[model samples]
Target: MQTSTETETFGFIVNDISRLIRAEMDRRTTEAGLGLTTGEGRVLLNVRRFGPTRQNLLAERLGVEAMTLSGLVDRLESKGYVERQPDPADRRAKLVTLTDEGEAVVCGMEPITAAIRADAARGIDPDDWQLLLAVLKVARNNLMAARAEAQSAESAAA
Candidate 1:
């Protein structure tokens, strides 16, 4: 029932915008001399946001491959930004926590992120922005629910 063009509009438009936003964020991070790639910055921010957590958990939250997350964490650890300690709750599992230097990077990122967000929303009305956020949140929840349902069905079949 759906036209190809109509079906494609949502995905392409959203994907393009997401890509551009990431590119702009990467540019700003480099211009600010943050000494982090966009991906690294993202990991740093997530660690800061969630506190000390397992690498696998962080990978899940970031929607990245575990190996990729491991590499990022390793780099960050060598740079003195993060450290991996044996999780108290699970000795076999390691928890990634930010060090003082990592905290500094997280602090430094706040203003840059704010500026980037402000720049992106420059012409948008605050009310409209809030409404847009609400719609997106619903869409995200719906997708998550669908994924969970599919996983459940797959597990049952197995």
Candidate 2:
């Protein structure tokens, strides 16, 4: 069995790196005056990518609680970044869609995102960076699958 110190050396490095990267992005986003917290930006990006989606589904996609997502949606709605409309097919549900300002904010994020990516990739060979990204993608997918399996087991047991 791996000792705690051994686990920390590998698993913890990956976890810590993720946290650090997020922290850096949060700092840079705030400094850029994007008028968004990192969590808000994450919500906006998700909505932009798969919008016109129900609130519960969005919350699931973001791996956040429904109430937490609702709060974020409320803030974004007030800021004109997103609008929540009653789902035509399901009145009890609300769909989140990006507004014109939200689209503009997403567009403006391109440069900021590029700069951050460039900084993060600094000194790394392009090929190595590409490989690292590919590996991370698979790792993320594996983790997601594991979470889904666990959820399914819990649901079945219940």
Candidate 1 structure quality by residue, lDDT tens digits, 67-89: 99999999999999999999999
| Model 2 lDDT, full chain set | 0.86
Best-performing candidate as measured by lDDT: 1
Clash totals, every prediction: 0, 0
Report the number of the highest-TM-score candidate. 1
lDDT for position 35 in model 1: 87
Error of 2 at 103 (Å): 0.7
Q: Enumerate residue pairs that collide in model 1.
A: none
Q: After superposition, how far is residue 88 of candidate 1 from its true place, in Å?
A: 2.2
- lDDT scores for all predictions? 0.90, 0.86
